[model samples]
Target: MTAFAEERRADRAADAEQRRIDAAAVDARRIEREKAADERASRLNEQRQTDRVRAREAQARTRAERRAARGEALTPGNVYRKGTLALVTASALGSLPAQVLHFVGISPMLLPLPLAIEGAAWVMAAGVAYADERHLPGWVRWFLRLLVLAAAGFAASINYTYGLHLPGLSAPDRQAAGIGLAAVTLLGPVLFEIRQWVTTLSADTNSPEERARRRHERKRRRQHRSIAQLADRFVSAAPFGQLDFEEAFAHAWEIETGTSTPGMTPRLHQRAARSTAALAQAQRSAVGDSTGRGLFGRLFRRQTESSPIQNPNQDESPQSITNRLGSDLQESAPETPPAGTEPPTPESADPAPAVAPEPVAGPVAEVEPVKSAEPPVLRPVAAVESGPRRATGRVPQSARTPRPTRTPDELLTEARSATADWPDEKLTAEAIRKAVRTSSANGRLLRDALKAERAERAVSEAQAA
Candidate 1:
């Protein structure tokens, strides 16, 4: 019973220990969750702070831009433009109401009459600006200017008459009021016209360099009158706005020169080719090249004349030189008396003066050369043929794989299939050449065909849309 009691105590202790462990695990998990939540809350605060700071910065930048734009400190021209706009606005507001009232007194339906008159004046003023921007004829500008003055004059007269007939004014006061009304009524469009003139006359409209360019262009047109006419013709023939004046002029130059490149001609190209080739040939001839013309012949001839000569049988070869050296050795070999004859002493030697050797050095008595039983071998001279050399980094024609020639339609069909998913820019001449393994010319042809096909497809799609 004591043993059973001890086991019961131990079981209780074990259960207590397990409970404590579970409590500790729960606490640890709770702590971890709290830590994660704290981290998330901290991150949220940081993100909110960052966004607030960014918004403040953006607002500050916008405010600064607004300030600069309203003040026009960054652009002085804006000051003039905005000031003119204000003056014109004030003038129009002062004049337009009087005209409207004067006309409205006549008829309610005639209210639009004053507005039309005022609109006509503004429209003519705007027409002057449009004419200037379009580089229209001076006559067109003058005509528009005359219309602006006429509209303004008509409005001013109406304003003056309305002021004169006002109910509250005396005679002299009416005249003054009439003059003032007429002056203010005319001043609005006149001020706008003046502003337009000032903008046109501003030096910034055309720089000195820009003026020089125009002068140069005009001079060139005068110099090349025919080319200019051709350029005009080309401009007229092309679709509107498809080609600019300069590009059309370039095409004209190409046509006139009979070449693909503008300002160059086939005749000039041939002449240049001849000149360069002649210079290269002259340079080659001046130098002692293997192809053989130069001072080499003259120099070598003089040397041969001064120096001991070689055998006539010698050709231009290493063996020929060796054979010549051998023959020389034999000729220069010390002569010996006949086998039976005694050698001559100084006493019996002839006292003749020492003499120089002849052109062909030899002994008075000839000794036979040692003959061989077999005939001498004759080696042929090495001949260097000047034919076209096989190009390095290229396969020989015989070694290359023979590719069957493909027609444009067949090749284009194949290319289209091969490159269906490829982008337009990737379908260049070189890329097509590598991908299709075709000639450069054929690659270009295929590229053009594919481009045309894609363009047509795009056009059709757009039309369908």
Candidate 2:
């Protein structure tokens, strides 16, 4: 029984050993599976990391592309600004040749003035490049441009004249250099203007649509500039920016030509200025006329109003009435005696009585009865049966012709007034007689007129002396 038990224990021990071996194998397999699983997990994590890296790289590439597109989009505006800078730089550089010649003693006499001019030109160029020309006065900008061009030409000419014979250069090289410099100098103004124009057109026009709009605007500006130049030549020189371009130019054209063009008319400001001037002139003329009338009217009123006070004690006789009316308006007739009384001797008759007194040719002088307390008779002159008519035939009273009446002093006044505008040389007695009558004139009236003329001449001479 003890031996059987030991064999059994040995068998059990073997069994236990076999079982341990199987367990160990199982453990080893489990370890191997865990190792394989860890390796697969690590491989999968690596693949995920690679995918993330690829995604990041793709995103970075897209960002780079987007940045490149935006840069391209912004390039035009920057380039335009750079072009302006370049033009200004070139203008400044145009002074180099003359400066070089001066430094080398080739153009010593032509140095200082040209150097100063070029320096000023450079400063102007820089200002013009950065500023908007539309804001500047046309004449000012034009003058500055001309100055710069002149400076460039002067510099180029000096270089050509003095620096052409530089020691190391061949004839061909010298000629080529001279020609090139001359060409650049002559074209300096044009090149600068074109460059400035390009800069202005390209500035702020980044997209194609904006550029197209700018081009259209430039075309319109060109048309307006041409019209403005024409208007300036014909009319007054109104600078740009001081007025509206199209309207100002149109008004100027109308004013200069004295007629309007087909599609253009004058502006409101131009019309307003003219209207204001005319209105002012009219007002001045009205004021002057009113002042003159008031002055003359006041003088006449004072004269008429004071006449009664001066002659209050004098009787109102026919002679006095004649004198008063003659002094007032210089139109009174000479006083005559009544029909029954003999005619008064003429106040202005000549002393010589060789010629018989002739009848006056103007209005008949008649005695005008004065207004008195007594009523006067109004009877026709009964023909004392005048001599000639009764002796010729037993003519009826109605058929008898009355004697010719003498002219009054009132007709002499009319004659004087009629000849007022006549020249002094044309105011002879014969001319006055001819103007007064187509036929013969009265000798008595002529003699009176002659006396009056002599008196007037004496008075004028005394005053002049």
Candidate 3:
């Protein structure tokens, strides 16, 4: 019975060992499969990235090709201009050859007189071409001028240097004279032909319509003298015209060139006046004085009184009374209700205290007590001496008198006020505002006047419609 028991135990142990090996083999296979899948994914991702890079490179190449083609098409005109410049440069350089020949005492026949002459003529022709005058065809004009000047210079230089045989007729002198005269005769017809060619080129270059248009423009400009004179007169007036003078002149120039100059002066003046009046009114309102008396007085007073007040307890270094007062007032104020809440009715509103409460001592003092349980209600009480209510709805007599109301006529008056001093081209909004404010008796009055004027304008516009 002991031997049978040992065999059974051995078999069971062997089976358990086999199961453990099988589990490890399965785990290894699963790991290998996962690694293969990851490798495949990496390869696919790399392929996609490569494809995108290739596409971008191809697109860039296409754009480069298009730009290259465009550059090629424009190259001819650029090359022509360059060639013209080169002609001038070459002519200047030719002088060096002539100077070298003279220094070397070369044969009169080899003298670079023609080359030197040609160079100077080319330079002059280049200048003429650059001017782009209307009478000549650009290329032909440049070529003819350069050629003629060069030929003339060549003939003159040769005649001066070696051609003339005056007191002594040396063999070299006779030869140079013959050569120079021959050159002049041969070149004269060439110059004449070039001139004729240039004239013909200019004629052929201009279309009949273009010639007609130019003629018409010239005629129109001549006829427009009166208008031009009028505009100039207006611009020169003492107060610069409210119109932008430069812009108006430019418009006039365009008109003389057969373009229309839109009539804008009346509209410009009307706009200027309106804006000026509006600005004046705003300034007056900001000053808080309608009567214009002591208008800016408060500003000066506030600035002068801004210094710190003397403290009773200098050793203790008393806290800023102003800051403390502000903080205390803020702390003592009741919290405002949410935005949607209905405001309290006049009858239900809590009245504000006439005076602030004194601060209490101790730790509780740090925690400010609310001065009023309810929001303070502002009551419009009539002053003992009744006066006009300001635009701000405050009684003027209580503190400052309200600014006076602007009349319609005062607002309209700004429209006709001399803008002749203003630069024709630069009618600034600020200038207009200043003019309007000064025109009105008071800012508030100016504002009212402007509003009434605008309303009238609207009514008029509607009636016209």
Candidate 4:
């Protein structure tokens, strides 16, 4: 019993010892797993932080590049420097011919040398200065170029012809003349540029103010054009009679500018057309009135009167007021007959029948009544009777199947069957077309079927004939 008890105690002790070792192994494995998880989390965090740093750096770099580009664009001095460089390059190229000549043993005085290089350089400098002061006109630049060419040509001609030695002139005097000529050529373009700059400055010293004023002026001009064009259309569509000239022009101006400002604001063409129509109406109303003496009356009378003088036979003394006064004067005067026509005799009492007057060619002329020889009669028309009195024929209305209406194929078949026994002249395509045209089917379908039938018949007739 003591040995058994000791063995049992040892077995229990070994089992507990084994359980502790297994628990220690499991705790170590769990520690290792926790460390690996922490390492992975740190690595992910490091990657995310690096990505954020790279993104921020990239954004900063982009912003710096854009800021630099903006700075370059806004600076005007850069443009001026570039223009100066270009002018210097052009000047150098222009001076190359003279430079080459001098490099060789050729004297500039012997040939037509291009001395314009110095003048061009000076002009370019002056132009750049003018551009800095105020915008330069394109024509000014072209004029400067032309001046350079002329100066060079004139200098070359003078050098070649006079050889810098005038009669009765010493070396110093000749040198002074040459210096004066060079000064004239160089200072001419510079002085012109300065004058242009002064003019520009005087005209518009403040740029923003001038720009605003010009923009406002342009807008006003456009408004005026629109108003004038509208007034012209109104004057053309409806004359001054339907539309009052003043009211129409005021309406047009109000439509464009929102104000009924009255003035002679209409265009020339519109004004002229309105005036012509008013003048015509005035002349029509002022006819045959000598007492109404005014501008309108005079215009009307001058157009209507054939005689130059108003009253050629007006006597100084006033005539007696009598109804027969003119008739008595005419009876007292002797009668005179024309050479071609005979005078009327008193013995012939019967007056000739008055000849019917011909109609005048105008809207206001009188129209003669047309006389008819006989009265018009009314007649009744006979009713047309067709073959059958029955309501329906051939196909009945109440049938199981609906009646097949005439189609193009059926129409052509019926037409050919009807004309089958006719002569060749009656059996033509035209006859077939006429026979089929009586049906209310599609004309195109009818024509297509006719074409097929015609082609078949043609082939059969060719074989038969």
lDDT winner among the candidates? Answer: 1
TM-score of each prediction: 0.41, 0.35, 0.30, 0.25
Candidate lDDT (C-alpha), each: 0.69, 0.54, 0.49, 0.49
lDDT of 2 by residue, 437-464 (tens): 4112222233334344534444345444
Model 1 TM-score (2 dp): 0.41
- Identify the runs in model 4 with alpha carbons over 4 angstroms from their true place: 1-22, 25-42, 45-91, 100-120, 128-465
Task: Output the worst ten-in-a-row residue range by lDDT, candidate 4.
Answer: 391-400
Global lDDT for candidate 2? 0.54
Q: How many residue pairs clash (N, CA or C atoms closer than 3 angstroms) in each of the candidate models, in the order given?
A: 0, 0, 17, 0
Q: Judge candidate 3 at residue 238 and give its lDDT.
A: 34
Model 2 scores worst on lDDT over the 10 consecutive residues at 388-397
Q: What are the RMSDs of all candidates, in order?
A: 22.0, 29.9, 27.9, 33.7
TM-score, model 2 to reference: 0.35
